[model samples]
Target: MRVLVVDDERGLTGALRRGLTAEGFAVDVAHDGDTGLDLATDRDYDAIVLDVMLPRRNGYDVVTALRAAGVTTPVLMLSAKDGEHDVADGLDVGADDYLTKPFSFVVLVARIRALLRRPPQVRPAVLAAGDLVLDPAARTVTRAGVPVDLTTRELALLEYLMRHADRVVGKVELRDHVWDGPGEDGNVVEVYVGYLRRKLGRDAVVTVRGAGYRVAG
Candidate 1:
């Protein structure tokens, strides 16, 4: 996969370029957000590792512009800010993933791999199923025109399901996309589906007996 590393830190960029190249990726480096934005706009990249603070345009603005321009390539943002709101803001701006500074390079590779695994397609900014609406960029969900609050895990699960609402997703598929937990137990899928059902009404998510779960699109 081809990846872009956009950060002002030269040493970090160099290290990432070498490390990611060693891991079998064609890595490109951009020291500021303007150069990053230009390269991102012109080239095709499988994933991007963007830093929050940059010289020209900030990472948030770059990602926002990319999404506005209909760029659906997955982006993994890098930042020193580890606060909850900061993370939420990154995702709200269309980042596919976020990692705090001084993070493990191993984890970074894992995250990039995860991003590459995602299906590349243009999806609506807001996903809808019946009266339920999910704004991925805003990280908000509403049911029947009313705001519905959900825990982070619940929201992630629902987002994945809603994104694939056209079909019945299996237990293993849900676990792979939703849970970052230790085990791949299919039971976790059932528990979270139950949680979603409770919050979104019993019939909100349909159970496919011996298959999996399906949500209306």
Candidate 2:
């Protein structure tokens, strides 16, 4: 799963990044709210860990903007203020859950998992194409009733393709969404596509020739 962590504290963000990464999540961190807002809007994240007190924009405003822009991706607000009003405000603005600072990392992970499991208004729980099946929450993929072992990148790539099955998705589009950022080499997308084709079968993903790729609908 992919998660975005938005906090102003460097130590906290770094620790969370390392911990979440170890727990099988592709985590992106932002020191301030502006960067967080941009990333949250541009990329698809399963869940967001947002700090209530942020620079540029507060967590409440950020969540409000996300909801206004129709980004239904779940958000878990993190704050030092553990008062009745603070908690209520976060939820009222659109946060799905809230965690107080100096919080347990285990609890945070559990909350994130819970958010990911909740039904998303914008995305499906599972994606399927042809004989392939992918469960995003479970992070499992199977083709023709047989399990397929895929690396994190491979699974992310397949999920993105399957979500847009039947449509030609450009390499740049895939890189922007599936990858953290542009790779050092431009052939990264090609390399991963090759990996997917090998595992899922060549006929699973179709090349549009000079344009991009499409998964069988």
Candidate 3:
């Protein structure tokens, strides 16, 4: 799953990014609320970890703006304050859940999983294409009920492609989302696509010539 963590505390954000990535999540971090809001608006994220005290915009304003703009992505608001009003205000402004600072990593993970499983618009816990099954939370992939081993980058690439199954996703698009930043060469996408095709089968991912690639639906 993809997650956006918005916090100005560099240490906290860095730790969360590392921890969440290790947990098999594709994570993106934003130091301030404006950047967070922009990222949330432009991209589709499974969940967001938003800090209440942010630069330029506060967590409440950010969530309110997102809701006003019709972004229903689940948000887990974070704050150092543990007061009743603080938690209630966060929920009242459309936060799906709230967490206090100095929180346990295990608890945070649990809360995120609970949010992902919430009713009405819950996303599938496992993503599938043809006979291939990918468990995002477990970071496991199986084909025809047999396990398939993949590197971190390979798993990330496959997850992004599978999320947009059957769509012609451009290399630039893949580079932007799957990769960490613009410093990565465009050829990396092709290299990883080749790797996925080999593991999943040549017919698994289709090349659109100069366009891009598409995973069979």
Model 1 scores worst on lDDT over the 10 consecutive residues at 176-185
Query: Could you tell me how far off, in angstroms, the CA of residue 22 lies in candidate 1 after the best superposition?
Result: 0.3
Spell out the clash pairs found in candidate 3: none
Error of model 1, residue 154, in angstroms: 39
Query: TM-score for model 3?
Result: 0.83
Q: What value of lDDT does candidate 1 attain over all alpha carbons?
A: 0.82
Residue 123 lDDT in candidate 3: 61
Identify the superior model by TM-score, candidate 2 or candidate 3. Answer: 3
Candidate 3 lDDT, 1-217, residue by residue in tens: 6789999999999999998877656689999999999999999787899999999999999999999999999999999999999999999999999999889998998898778767435567788988888886687998889898998888878877887785898888787667654677769988998998888888878999989998876
Query: Residue-wise lDDT of candidate 2 within 1-217, one digit each (tens)?
Result: 5789999999999999888876656678998888999999998887899999999999999999999999999999999999999999999999999999889998998888778657564456788888899987677999999999998788878888887886899988787666655643688889999999999898888999999999876
User: Model 1, residue 57: displacement in angstroms?
Assistant: 0.8
lDDT of each: 0.82, 0.86, 0.87
Estimated TM-score for each candidate: 0.56, 0.80, 0.83
The candidates, ranked best first by lDDT, are 3, 2, 1
Taking all chains together, the TM-score of candidate 2 against the true structure is 0.80
RMSD of each: 12.0, 3.1, 2.7
Residue by residue across 1-217, what tens digits does model 1's lDDT show? 4578999999999999888766645567899999999989987676899999999799999999999988888999999999999999999999999999999998998887667556565556678999999875566889999988887667777877787898998877676546523365658889988998899889888999888998855
Better of 2 and 3 by lDDT: 3
